[model samples]
Target: MSTPKLYAGLKLREIRTNLGLTQKAFAGKLGVSLPYLNQMENNHRPVSAGVVLALAREFRLDVTELSTDDAERIVSDMREALADPVFGPAAPPIADLRLAASNAPALARAFLDLHRAYRRTHERLASLDEALDTKDATLRPSPWEEVRDFFHYCDNYIDAVDRAAEHFASPAGRPGDPMRAAQEALAHQGVTFTRADGPWLRYFDPDTKQLTLSSRAPGSTQRFQALHQVALLAQNELLEATLDLARFQTAEARAIAKIGLANYFAGAALMPYRLFMAAAQETRHDLERLADRFGASIEQVAHRLSTLQRPGAKGIPFFFVRVDQAGTITKRHSATRLQFARFGGACPLWNVHRAFETPGRFLRQLAETPDGVRYLCLAREVSKPAGSFRAPVRRYSIGLGCEVQHAGALVYADDLDLTRSFEPIGISCRICERPDCHQRSVPPLERRLSVDPGKRGILPYEIGG
Candidate 1:
């Protein structure tokens, strides 16, 4: 029996029909003859890179989706075919194939679409498995995980404004203070700040050529405004450099990684590596003192402190997590090899939730997992920016922690009792098989148990030992 053809000519034809475009009109948009376009849709010709790019740009669709015809097998086949030497011996032929890719676009479109579909499907399956194991499973992998992994491997930290500032201040070592340098950089970009009556107008005229800054908070707010200005001016260069460093083979992956890297650079620029690392070590990772010195919020100082793992010159390895009252984790970053349950919710006993009860007060706790891994947790609540006086403001919490062995290096552990029998918690339900845990939001895998109404336990159900 012959192998089934994975080409997606039919799908291309469907897309053309959906667009309400005639063959001739579609061909014209691709800069190809109608017959050539028809040939591609009929699988008489192969799809190339140029055609894929055109379809992606013109239709505003993901290139992979457009190329793979939304089929995984087709994408796998195409990748295999591209790796074959039988296509040609010379580079010029491949270059030509790329130039006239639109003329034979079906194959390329089919391959990309299939790959994306496969990835999404696999991720969904993983999520389902996690859900069955733990009730508090995540909707997907943490976005911060995706972002941080991209930056750690990628090279080239080129930021345009930073570059311009570096060039501008090459003779003076990029200015003495990072905040002052950032302010000067923004001035060069025609962005200026002025005091405003309300907090809603903190950053104004974002649509205009000249950006404006307005804030109610006197000191730290000004520093944040400068940081944002730097981010705006340097985002593109930082994104491009980081993406290049990541070396993503697919266009889709590159685009996603770019956004994450740009955010990373913005955060880094605001913190300034050298000074931040120095302060973290001196203060023993004290959030309050670091916040005061940098004119940053408590959360900002903690977040920056977590990213201080730059190889040989690293500070204490820390994990930072952010969550709202609803228990949804918004951000997570770790320098150590901390394993988070990919599919379930965090332990309710964790000190992160305690921050909400105390509002602005910081809470510290020692926690250990069944695996014997211990952690030192410091958590505090933070309020979101308010829109208007009548509008209800929202508050969220952030948690910063490190291993128990490294706890002594942090100021949060100074007054806390290290020997206290703190609560034992796990990252997620499926991985944590603690039989007597009253806080188990979901049951562990392969464990059968039922609730006995006559003998009610601390939790809803009793697990068989």
Candidate 2:
């Protein structure tokens, strides 16, 4: 029987085009020659295990995707091509062809790249199809959700580092600078740092066994780099261990979880849990002074402050949230048992939205829900790191809040008038049954609308009035 031809070549070409990358550029990125890339795309090669692993690591791709059935089919096709008897005496033996496919480094790399591209395309198409089939297509996870989850689970831990910094800053002789200690810790782990010129100046070279730290300065972002290094070393094992425990079904899910756990560990490592909690209690959760002492961003300080809710050693009871200019909640962590609406839209009149208009300036407000539960909020715009001038994204505005009675503890409420009536807002339109709210993007799924012209309300038309 004739061997069934695999369209691996076509898939490779399609992915290259989809990413708008030239054959040469793709080859360079993969650390392979153009001819080798072309040969793999043409089904003149078979993938090997090492190259498959390399593709997964380099592209942050799923390993299962790189070792698909399509790759097996391509291998079958190559075998059939070698057995054809047309070339006669000058033709290489089938054994020779098999050896070349198996041993040739370039051919192995090409096959791996082709397989990886195919897997990525296949998964993307499947996600789109699933999105199309769902009712209330808009109900599907938004880009904001993905971004927020990425940060949350990926364990981006500036919180932990800042906590560590604060912990060591006591009267019993400071343990050098927290940043210097972090740097020293990284060096102890055999990770060397060097200044480089690039958008991603910091990259780990597994081959050279070096973690190069970039010198790109966003004003006071140097301390962040130091903390990040500490995260790489101190939190690496913990992050890996957490991911191992997660046992995610898909490689993609596992990859994301691994990143999240790493960030979490990073935060935990930076802020030794016990010390940070103690400091929070002592200062009543003053973010500015906390940030100053730890050399961390305010957002980092606030996030750590919220995590001090351990069973016995709790600090201030608070909730933390981060939103962009579009009022999208990118990060939400709460110590209180308050229910937060996960999807739909957020309130535009909230202090979080107002903070974006006055970037870098902090704002304070007292918010009260229908249940009469009042809270104090501190909102400020946190600048997003720009990758390049051409693709600039908006800075984020994050809000940190606590119960109204705990307002005196925060610096934001000290100067502001507590009696002023601020706009009342909810987490999202679906959970919030508030009528006449102009910010309502979509009505609640469970709420039935009444359409009487005379009795029509402003926002939600009244559920079965």
Candidate 3:
């Protein structure tokens, strides 16, 4: 099969604009004529191999960004947004959606923002308490959702924070015990670190300059908490700068995003990028092996693997999600084309749900989405014990997977037939185009359905063509 032609006009324009280069200068640097560069920028012509090479050599660009296809993410989000019952059954065709995503991404984002605002307004009016609260009546995206979208659009990678965490882990430019490094970093700042048996995992008293970590928590959690504090104390300016770039509308969103960046810093410091990526490649991404090598938990290892989206040196494009027992997607990030549902729970057919049934073992699945993308998915159940028998345990299942093309690099993909049948899965029932799924909870909004009182198959109504 021939490769698809690349038409990344927006990304090309963005790169040139960021460098403050005019069409002529950018064309000269890219070893292309002004007319040819203009044609490529307008997407009249596909970007050539020569231009890709020139981008790498002249601009030191990550060539992969040219064909990154953020349009896919936009398209998925639009589909989900249109699935709202308020939109009715006559939504725009998928082709038109793709065109809007590719040619007019900003407009598409604006439409999504409008739809999100409408939904929030509708929800607020439906609730009695929020509707009656007349003092503050701002209709905006939830702080958590805003932060999630920020990370989602960023491909779950923050370059500056990631590099800062790496430098903190290796002050002398060499990998060492990240925990010890964090402890010493805190000590240097005249902060006292102590472990005490209590409910709070990690708490810093600003007045006393004392950091208390729960003794009952596992060593990995304690280490991660320490790094998290390091991020806030040592990398405050960087975090604040990054938040400024985000320019969130609400103070709540900014505060939540600060915490998120700190968490990202902790994860990055715990598993330094280059070192962790090398270890992952060497170990074929065995979560247990990675956890042992990095002094991290399996869930942390899985999440860190998804964030290895460094510009020049990127790891496999993987998708990571953590779901509670009830199947709600608590945490999600995808570096691949498979974007998760922005609302509601995960697909029931996916193996991540079965993870809760079998604790302490990895469940492997060869699954295909409705769009024909196949993946080698791995999931395992993780239980966080809260120190005492009276305390409730936090149980969540984490899923990690990459496209089938990169499945060979995963140890979990061994002994599986990569060319054969794959179990079908969808993002969500409301937006999924698959009509014959038995596990579907609701009819697809874009398809017509016929109901008959006398007949019933897997569903009460038959979907129309």
Clashes of each: 22, 16, 0
lDDT of 1 by residue, 291-324 (tens): 8776678877887777665433456767788887
Regions more than 4 Å wrong, model 1: 1-179, 192-208, 217-222, 247-262, 446-455
Task: Give residue 116's error in model 2 in angstroms.
Answer: 28
TM-score of candidate 2 on Cα atoms, chains taken together: 0.60
Give the clashing pairs for model 3.
none
Q: Could you tell me the TM-score of candidate 3?
A: 0.94
Candidate 3 lDDT over 1-465, as tens digits, reads 245577777889999999999999999998899999999887778899999999999888889887544788998999999989898878888778876887798899999888988887777767755553653443567788889999998989999999999888876766799878888989988899999997799999999999999999888999999999999998899999999999998899999999999999999999999889999999999899999988999999999999998988989999999999999999999988899998899999999999999999999999999888889999899999998979999999999999899999998888999988999999999888898999999988888989999998999999996
* lDDT per residue as tens, model 2, 231-348: 5566666455555664544465666655554455445545556666666667767777777656667887888777664433456667788877667676776544233444433566
- Candidate 3 lDDT score relative to the true structure: 0.90
Ten consecutive residues with minimal summed lDDT in candidate 2?
Answer: 80-89
Best-fitting candidate, measured by TM-score?
Answer: 3
- Comparing 1 with 3 on TM-score, the higher-scoring candidate is 3
